[model samples]
Target: MAGIGPLTQDWEPVVIRKKAPTAAAKKDEKAVNAARRMGADIDTIKKFNAATNKAASSSTSLNTKKLDDETENLTHERVPTELKKNIMQARMNKKLTQGQLAQMINEKPQIIQEYESGKAIPNQQIIVKLERALGVKLRGKK
Candidate 1:
């Protein structure tokens, strides 16, 4: 009789519960005020506002003006001659065939051969794209 009773023993499934917000969450009104001031178009404001109040308040501030100046300085530096040679060498070393390389970079096979042979100079934008695609730097006179 005892064994038969054990066969029907009740079992309950376990349920997981999430923690409730603390007291600090209840008094958090800054976000509400910000949304009100930003208006119903708050989503647009957030998207366009490059600089955020929270970001400005943080100690690690971004000096965008300084970044611009540094970028300008870097642009003026002359291209390293060795980098140009290496770019040409990399294509040859890969044994990709000029046509293959051209296809990979979305250019004509003759263009790839011309660049590799140093017969013509690629435009700045083309050089950048090629450098990234080939994983090699192609530096030349600025």
Candidate 2:
């Protein structure tokens, strides 16, 4: 309802669908039918379906996943103390101020300061960004 468009248009008319498959899709359908006729079993069909669905879904999922992985703390976990020490040491070794390091990693200076002061532990992704920006390994690396 709140979008840049004609405010009163019926959505049904806006939704147009192709009744025919594209050439590539039609070729794929023929190949699948041929495989079926050649005695492709249920397991083979299932594998093909799974692979195709995964391929189709992955592209749309990438951007969403990138955003989620960057921002979401999936386990509600914090950076460990050892990692905090490493972050602070790394930032100091890099000869960068907290604000400068924050700018390098696209974070708030408060965030860098918090990590350095060990007052608040950052999320895993932020730890990774800091590690990369500061050229130091923080946590979970062998």
Range of the 10 consecutive residues with the lowest summed lDDT in candidate 1: 71-80
Give one digit per residue, the lDDT tens place, for model 1 in 98-129: 78778888888877666656665546776776
In model 2, how many backbone clashes occur?
Answer: 0
TM-score of each: 0.36, 0.42
Tens digit of per-residue lDDT, candidate 2, span 1-142:
6777865955665667877757997888788888889988633343455545677777889988888779645664455688778887887788889899999999899998888667774687887788788777787672
Which residue ranges in model 2 land beyond 4 Å of their true spot? 1-78
**Clashes in model 1: which pairs?**
none
Regions more than 4 Å wrong, model 1: 1-84, 140-142
